[model samples]
Target: MNEPRSTYPFIARGASAELFDMGGGQALKLFRDSVSDEMIAREADASAHAAACGVPTAAATGQRIWDGRRGIIYPRLEGATLMDWISRNPMRAGWALDRMGEIHAVMHRVDGGTLRSLKQVLATDIAYGPAPDALQRAAIAYLETLPGGDALTHGDFHLGNVMMTPHGMMVIDWSKAAAGHPAADAVRSEMLMRFGIGPSDWVTNLWRDWAARRLRRSHAAASGVSTRDIDAWRPVVALAWLRARDATGRTPAFMRYLDGALKQAGLPFTG
Candidate 1:
């Protein structure tokens, strides 16, 4: 496909790509050259598969080449992300978190359909993560005993990845889409909310902790997955996160939380 004209206004930039407002009610997600074609292709396929399975996401309308970088076109979605909305309407955080939980449950209802396995993804991450050899082995062995499922999982699901539009909430960024147990995905979401890079002030940290609990409760209720099941997946997920987490965000509180999860799951500490 032809590169978008210089006139296409810039919209936003993320870790891997820059978005442009492609005229005609569409947006262009032009990925960086450093991003592999295979990764981009997986995201494109996963996005289409998700939409076909009735997941609320912007399906790729087309693919294009902008200069040397690859890009995908999608129907432009208008509105603030769930994160931004929550920031602006802190009083409604409960409602928003509840809605997010419900939406996540609904997404998990669909079959992953040819997507990569979430367990394998987690195992790979843990194998390559910073955990001690014994800890990694213990976590991977433990991971094997956990239940697996074909349910669709938005591997990177969180408030920031969800958009609150006029129609409703639309999930974006399928780069990390995978098939796995709903409980495992829920654990991942909990970790992201509590420890992912962001403001770490005491107030924000308290809110984050509360928001994670609220989201987990909502998801458990909607999905019929127990908190115990989610907890069972937590240690491995937390271990794998060490591979990709921002060092700046690895504060003392996060380390304590990680240790608690590991201890609860009977896994070795990272140190």
Candidate 2:
């Protein structure tokens, strides 16, 4: 692991990165060595774009190096994540799901100009993934058949990414933001909600499934989009997610979920 610079104290840690309290209401998001400079730039640009489009987001101050690791400076806001709220107040999970839908609706209405293409990203993932060449070609072909649009899609939208702040609910992590069909974005959320990485008890899985369905309904209503449309992208989204999890070499269960999703989409499973 790369050592964190002493300028800030450790705040939290995630699978791929670490957060440090930088004082002055700011935080440093130091990334692992595997993260490339280009990836960081893409995330920064996407964050700026989301903020400009009226989506609540952390204020990205600038980028700096900490102990030879690349990091971004952000104004750390006070609030619990939607996931935290759900876990603490299970009875009110419905409310949290509704809020998620409302916020996501606001995002889909905006045009994602010149940011990045969701199609291209999926195509690249498939090409580089462990799947056989035939499966990769089929997935890419399926992606091409989908309708295109200019809507802003948070490529990794899920409960954990939405931070409920004093101001309001704000989004974090713009590494996967892209311009494409809203259904593509919606399907990605569904997949993550249904089968995320990490261990979980049966009860937790049940609650997650319920919450995921609620989220889908609420998002469809708020955005005036149909679940049928979002569901159509399920297969392609699953394949792309499989490539992501495979790269991490974790979440074997999630990999299985993707395989099932692929089969459901009428594509051959290549796990």
Candidate 3:
């Protein structure tokens, strides 16, 4: 349990972890006390697995306990997150989204090997989520009928999780990696881009909707996964999301979207 030096430069903080510049081109991701050992282990293992399988990500180089908190060290990656880049270069959002879609397609080509099943994860979330028991039961039953796959799915893939590095786009944060159908993962990405926590002004939302559409088209083209396949998974995925989403993400618009998806999929509506 080596402690980080007091001189280590603090970098940034996220909901679950804090980052520090450890010099020598390394960075430490120190998890908060609330983060479980299982999650930390999963992220380390998943990141290494993704890198070994040719996914462009920074694998954990080492692990340490600092001040009783778990930390993983990774080679410092240089560049802004794809989300940040898009914010700064709004006019080039389409190009950036195209690249994001292509990269995601490439990632799905790899096998998830031994990672947790995506369907099971979703079922669990739906079971514990805010949906009515009837809806939860129906959603889980329908989810079982959907096709399954071993493709590597970045459970939380989004623009914010990808970096536009000098070397190219590199994905970060493997905490939610899973083995699942690519289309399901694609649907999750759509939800994130369209409804994840962010500014919700009418103009911003319109752009977000457009961006989500562009990304879906690009991913579908590159992956040979049809929009129908993605759409089929939307209702269940949206229901599962209710378990973990914050209040800001529970807007009336999102509820309507969820209702629409459920209706489209022939599942019981939230009403």
Candidate 4:
């Protein structure tokens, strides 16, 4: 580990923070830079919120500085992230997938657990931008027909976000947390899993199938999301991609999605 022993650090490399291997299996997640304060705080906030809601998670029971940066000291979780485990366990894929759907539903009600720095601003700065008269008309019309139901969105939940532990599994990374439409979050999540699994094969399809079946069984009204729902969020998510808002390694494809989304929503790509 690059970090020193006195600080007792290990490395976890959060999307916005650098994790160091602390002594005796503990870990310290330090800010990569000031730009990461929001992200760093997001982890702390989500972990605490999970505890408050009685969700199982790594106990972030301490704090300290390491590698010339400030961070939280969390009890180092044992075992690989769920993705690692899933890679070698195709036989258990079905049960694992069903478990993920339950996790998603459980997590959706978390208090602002789906909140994010970029998402809240996206609606104001990008999605609802002052467009040409024609574009504005299109968006307004689309919104009128769109469904409205808010829930905690994990912003970027997937198997990778899940950590397998001796006790069970735990969720991590709250930078994408937000309170908003549930399907938007789920669709974005499903897309993230797409690279790992295709539309027809792999765990992505399995999870989607499981989630769809679960939703159908669910009492909550969560059935309208489909290719249509993804198309709905695509223009804005595409703009986010074009602007390099996220490091999801998917800007080109998302922009491609933008054109398709425009066509699906009954408009030509003005940009």
For lDDT, the strongest prediction is: 3
lDDT of 4 by residue, 144-256 (tens): 45554456566667777777678777877656666666566665565555432324434555554464444323313333345556567655544333333442444344445
Can you give the lDDT of residue 132 in candidate 4? 56
**Descending-lDDT candidate ranking:** 3, 1, 2, 4
- In model 3, residue pairs whose N, Cα or C atoms come closer than 3 Å (at least 3 residues apart or on different chains), thus clashing, are none
Candidate 1 lDDT over residue span 32-139, tens digit each: 878888778878888898888888888987889876678998999999999999889989999999989998999999999888899999999999988889888999
Worst 10 residues of 3 by lDDT: 1-10
Number of the predicted model whose TM-score against the real structure is largest: 3
How many Å off is the CA of 145 in candidate 2? 1.5
Find the number of clashing residue pairs for candidate 4: 16
lDDT of 2 by residue, 244-268 (tens): 6532323565667767778877788
Predicted structure 3: clash tally: 0
Between the candidate structures 2 and 4, which one is better when assessed by TM-score? 2
Give the range of the ten consecutive residues with the poorest summed lDDT in model 4: 215-224
Better of 2 and 4 by lDDT: 2
Of candidates 4 and 3, the better by lDDT: 3
lDDT of all predictions: 0.87, 0.80, 0.89, 0.58
